[model samples]
Target: MKKINLKTTIIILSLIIISILFINNLRINKADNLSKAIVLKTNNSNVISSGVTNIGHQILTVKVLEGGHTDSKLKASNHFTGTAEIDNYYQEGDEILISIKEKQGKVTAVKAVDLYRQHWELLLFGLFVLILILYAGYTGLRALFSFVASVYIIWNILIPGLLAGQNPLLLSSFVLVLLTGIIIFSIAGFTRKGLAALAGTLSGLFITIVITIVFGNNMGLRGMTAPFSQTLLFSGHIDLNMKHIFYASIIIGASGAAMDIAMDIAASMEEIKLKKPDIEMKELIQSGFNVGRAVIGTMTTTLLLAYSGGYLTLLMLFVSKNTSLRRIINFKMVSAEILRTLTGSIGLVLVAPITALFAGWIYCSDFFIITWLKDLKSHLKFLRP
Candidate 1:
């Protein structure tokens, strides 16, 4: 049996403890004012109710009673249109479970779903974790732990900080740096490779932020372009700057690509070092640049595809309406999407070269540059003497 290193063992233990704490925290602070209830029945019609607008969509005022172990009886009003598939699943008197929260003595069902109660997704997720642990062992466990940590950071730290009227850009930048450091170190360990990847990732992230901020402002991409941003306004969260939220989201979205490029460059450099440890510094730098060139194209397209996938329906809407190209691209949401995709692409492009340069310099520093130059000078001096 292979002996486990003390550092690796400690890391594994720390991650396991943190994972437990995070899950417990989430469970404890979960929204409890809301109750899950079944949809005993639903009333739907085209006529607009008093104080409600039809808005070209069907309206339903669902009547529900508390479900599960709670015996509490309650009535809730929920808005449903044909847009979501849940509306199609509803039949008169069908048993549908809805999550309802109380406000001012009235219960409002924010989200409702038919509960046949299948744990398939949960089961699959558990199986995935198990397979990862079984095959990859400690590293797999670390990856899972890092993933959990990332989610916690985003939800518990970043979201709350942004909503609490903190500077969105500043808070997001800080979170990105913290998350990158934690994730890289957790997965790659505190080694030269991890440091190289971290440097590249941070560099890419900074460039992404700069590009996002400049163009986001010039393009008039309001933060309200994001889903639920306007709802936050009406929901009485004051002093929350929507524009800053958009800026933060841009960097967060770009960070994944930045990390990818950094890792790619660092990994390539590490391989080159292993194969030829005596490779010249200039040659190693060139090798990293070459690898980066190959990655930049597809990675930028990946960003484009990712951002575009979310807006396919919106694009179709514009086309179906016969909207002009200029107008379609100029729409607030469309413009925001464009800015996000392009800004991320720019970061990816710059990150390739920056990461390659840094990885080359750090990985081959001793023999490739300094030692080679010193040897050359000594040879010349001996010849002169």
Candidate 2:
């Protein structure tokens, strides 16, 4: 067993302490109602004009008249006209400020000075990163860097390109290839292993893109099936072709699995070479195939599980409604997911053999073409001379 070095121990301890401190600071600075403000405005008209009001709820109505001098003064009104419960302590024309909460463009809650919810996800995220650094060490740091790069590329390049009316299928395909290169090479470094992974990942991703485009169109998977897609239309900001987005998403989502399979096969081949440098071409290729067979089974299932998990609630709703299998499967989102997951799985299967053949030919001694040609020439020249 390798002994723990002093540097590693200190780094681990420092990471733990930093994680605790950051978490504690996040808890201390959480939301409080003291930061809120309540204001009131008055309309002096004797005729009380009421907007839409629902029973069993309270409303705070503020009237701002045109060309009113009160705008500069931040006016507070003591006069309000509304029905209140008998037990509610308020005099007629008394100064009172009411709080209103709007949900989906309608008032839902009327409470005073409620504390805004503090989102703790960022703090939890920090702790998660710290934990990863402390435990996994160098590998964790590389994974983190890759994750950040993925986010940056997606947000800065892919999204902007989509919004600019670039062809979704083409842009997404290009982005996926770029991301695969960055992610695999950054994690694995520049080596034969990295090259093998890059080749496998690119081949698989291309296959996935082709499959998604063909099947997604045939299945009539509309992009509007995704949540908030209609909202983007209503907002008047996005003039997008929805079906193209659906096709793009299929390819983009599948690229992750492609990269995983490629990396796994490449890494396994690298390990094999390190262990048995003298392994022949046939055996080395077989070794890669063997490892790929084991990986593909789980990886295919992983794609299914990941894609299906998002729609479990929708599936349950369909089941409860006694929807027929034909109808359920015909749903746009369901069909899209099926195409995405299955197409990506197919890509993974193809990538394994493709990578194995290339890696074997490149790394194995017996199959090296240049070396073989050189030796053949040397033997033939003696006979000729």
Candidate 3:
């Protein structure tokens, strides 16, 4: 009862702290530089025609609904550019996001950036939460809290901190550690199992960090391999280490798989201990190793499939071009994907033994073993009579 109460109190306090931090961060990053707009009309239907490989641009007339030009609803003309496959064609009553420029407290210019689809996004998110709650019950609520906390930390804390020129490796590692502790303890409760899992998870994360740093350097990659990262370097008020960010991403990506294996080993060991209180330490450790082996098989395959799925189009393109297999394997993007998947899978494999050791020490008590042995001796003597 005491343990349960303590866990409950900690969870409540965590939620409160997270709520306060989220609101504060939201205020700090408020969207004051942009105005909400509704597309009134396209004043010029003529688009600047570009080559077949390029997208055309258009001009839009919009009514400013928010910002310094609030409530006036004056028509403003702006340039429009579509992103990826989405056309920047705005029809009547289509709400959109507009970047406004101000000079002398008056709106000088407006540019259409994208559409505002907050309502649809919220509906989808709500449905996801509903499904989780229905399937997992109270545990689902805990998982939901952890998921939201993680997203908030990534968006508000990690991204902002990186933009502020903080060291990506250090900041990211700190956040990963913080998140690992919160998630494991929240779901596993304040028990030996949680503690064991936490230890194993942290160890696995540390291993990943070291491996990424060492191998990332040897790969002769500068992290500019990301298409948008180069553009970001030219765009803003931030100086970032692209390579370090890449390394940090590798570590963070692997942390989830590591934590999963750790928790699984811890839970299985605890269950074994519960069913056989007198189970020897060696036997308990062996049971954990058995569980780890079973999980690692499917988990590694999952990593391979997930990493490959993202690059299916690229693979298809290579096939169409009749690119040699050696060239495709030597490609930078392909190598990076390989590095990420293998490193993460290795971390998952390591977490098993580490967690098994911790759980064995926690759940296997010498007192229980002694009692079981004494009972067995008495039974043997009585059977002789």
Candidate 4:
């Protein structure tokens, strides 16, 4: 009883420490220049068209919704860049993100930054949490906690380390380990199921890293194929290794799916073991392998479908252009997606077997020795007959 209590205490303390670190790492920088405002009025009479694009400055009357400038009405200007991708079209009653310039604690100027979407974002998030808790109950709640931890690790540890010019693979590997352990143990507890899942995820991810590095080098494409990667490179991070970062992204992207496969195998095997306490090691292993085989078939296809779906527009473009299969496959963007899909699928395939192997051994070890002896004696008696 004492031992159990001590173990519980240790677990609780460790969780507390991790929570503190996660909070500190995810600290948001409060910007004094930023404020939320509602677009009260917009004038488009002076707008002019340039070629196929609108190139005019929009004048707006915005009422501040936050800060000391609350309820203050100010005139704001939004210039059209003739680029639809970078511009926001605001209507009255639309909440917007804005930057305020102040002189001696008085607002002198304001500029619209973006359409404020936080209210809907929060509403959706709350609905999601509510649905998850209601459906999966405690397990869903635990999953939510893991989800939060993941956001913090990615935003804080992974992003900052990469920005600081740290070795991308190393930093990403550290992040992977942290996330794998936390996410798996948090959901599965510190039992054999969690251990098996963690070990399998790390091992599979390690293999993924190797495959990505080797294939990425020979692919003859810079990691700039990713959206915003080019922008990021030119945005004062010229020293960062975009290739390694891309490799890291592949691992990170595949990790969630890999964990799913591992958990499936581990959890299935764990249930099997609980039901059949005296199950032989060989039988248990075979059961795990069977479960792995079944899961991997769909899981690999699932990965492919997921990657392909995300690039549906690109695929549509290829179809519309009637591009040859060879040419389509050779395109850098298509090739990158292929690599990501195949590499992730390959890792997931391995994770199932690896997790099954470990879970079978760990779960069966305690009972297997005795079970094996009894089987051996019974077989000997049969031989004597």
- Candidate 2 C-alpha lDDT tens digits along 1-385: 7675543454456455545655565456643212222234323443343453112322323322222222222332233335332212222233333343446765454343222223355687788889987987766765665666677678668987988889888888788878887777557655567767888778777777777778877777777877678978788746798888877887777778778887888888888999988888899989999999999999899989998898888889998999999997777778777777888788889988888887787676434554554565566442111
In order, the Cα lDDT scores of the candidates are 0.74, 0.67, 0.78, 0.84
Model 1 worst lDDT window (10 residues):
51-60
Whichever of 1 and 4 has more TM-score, that candidate is 4
Per-residue alpha-carbon lDDT of candidate 4 for residues 1-385, written as tens digits (9 for 90 to 100)? 3343443444456546667877564344545467899999998876786665677878999999988789989998888888876877778998998889888987787888889887899799889989998998657766777887787778878888999999999999999999999899778765667878898999999999999888988997578888789889899999989988888989999999999989998999889989999998788988989999999889889888988898898899999999999999999999998889898988998888888888888887756544654565466442110
| Candidate 1 lDDT over residue span 51-120, tens digit each | 3333232233345454443655444444445344343344455444555666776655445544534356
- Per-residue CA lDDT of model 3 for 70-100, tens digit only, reads 6555555544343444455567788988787
> Candidate 4 vs. truth: CA RMSD?
7.9
Candidate 4 off by > 4 Å: 1-28, 46-53, 366-385
Best by TM-score: 4
Error of 4 at 108 (Å): 4.0
| CA displacement after TM-score superposition, residue 240 of candidate 2 (Å) | 1.3
